[model samples]
Target: MKAGFVIEEHVVVYCDGCGDHYSEKDNESICFHSIAQAIAYFSAHSATVGWVYDGDRILCDGCIATLHCLQYGHTYPDTWQTTVWPLGKLTRSRSCAECGIPEIEAQS
Candidate 1:
């Protein structure tokens, strides 16, 4: 005799800002067993991870940072200081003029 089983459907939440979803496995979007589960998960992790989950919309960390920079603008210096590594890799560093945020970028 064959056994019977049930397959259930779940909801997947996506970020409103970038259209990306959270994934615990890092391979695919997370599937919540129910809407309550999704809400609970987001409520627990959102604030700590810089995610915005306001029931209707979700925003990830990168999107939040980008939005902040766009609204206020980055105050990087006019010229970035460049450094050359032994292996010929080049990097540039600068501090924002307004907020004094340090930024580093690698050049290819």
Candidate 2:
């Protein structure tokens, strides 16, 4: 008779931004049995998933968005021009800011 030991493998994903592992509510790290499974899961849940695997690195949603904004440009609320109407209405507008983007806001 031959005796053999069984070994299990798990893949732990980490966020490049915060240097934290993907975790559940109980703080348990989310692990996958294989790299293919990890990639498939992330790809399938990309929209609702809070983290992203951006080819070279894994990043939290906020970090990825911030990186994109830094590379392209983003709008700031403080940069928006706001006006208040006598009827208690508010309007804000910013055209072609540093990001070359236009924005408008209307409130009542």
Candidate 3:
């Protein structure tokens, strides 16, 4: 007779900016369970005011906000024009089926 222990393991993807790890079960849009997904998402969109996952890490919300502040002197929260205007005058380069939707709201 033999006794053995079985341990279940979960893989987590880490956000590059904050080093925060997220699992597949986590419903947060900012994090992804796979690095390939993160890379695909980041490379697909323009880094105007949203999250970007570099090859190594997902530059999380806080970091993106910081980048905006550093580059433009203020954070444009969920501003469509700021993000859209630069994409060759509101043109999406590729099909946006896999792209995550930006949280849209009026900027006060």
Error of 3 at 19 (Å): 2.2
lDDT of 2 by residue, 1-108 (tens): 546986767998878897877775787888899988988888888678778876777787667666777887775556778889897899988764343455778965
Worst ten in a row by lDDT for model 3: 91-100
lDDT of 2 at 16: 85
Give the runs in model 3 whose Cα sits over 4 Å from its true position.
Answer: 1-6, 23-50, 75-108
Query: How well does candidate 2 match the true structure in TM-score terms?
Result: 0.53
- Which candidate, 1 or 2, would have the higher TM-score against the true structure? 1
Each prediction's whole-model lDDT (CA)? 0.80, 0.76, 0.50
Candidate 3 lDDT tens digits, 1-108: 546986544345556767754333456535455656656756786365355665555675666666655665643333243335533444322221222334343322
- The TM-scores of all predictions, comma-separated, are 0.60, 0.53, 0.37
For model 1, residues 1-108, the per-residue Cα lDDT tens digits are 546896769998777888877775654888889989988888998877667778787887767777777789987778989999999999999986644568999999
Candidate of highest lDDT = 1
Name the best candidate (by TM-score).
1
**Each prediction's RMSD to truth:** 5.8, 8.9, 12.7
lDDT at 26, model 1: 56
User: How big is the RMSD of model 1?
Assistant: 5.8
Instruction: Sort every candidate by lDDT, greatest first.
Output: 1, 2, 3
lDDT of 3: 0.50
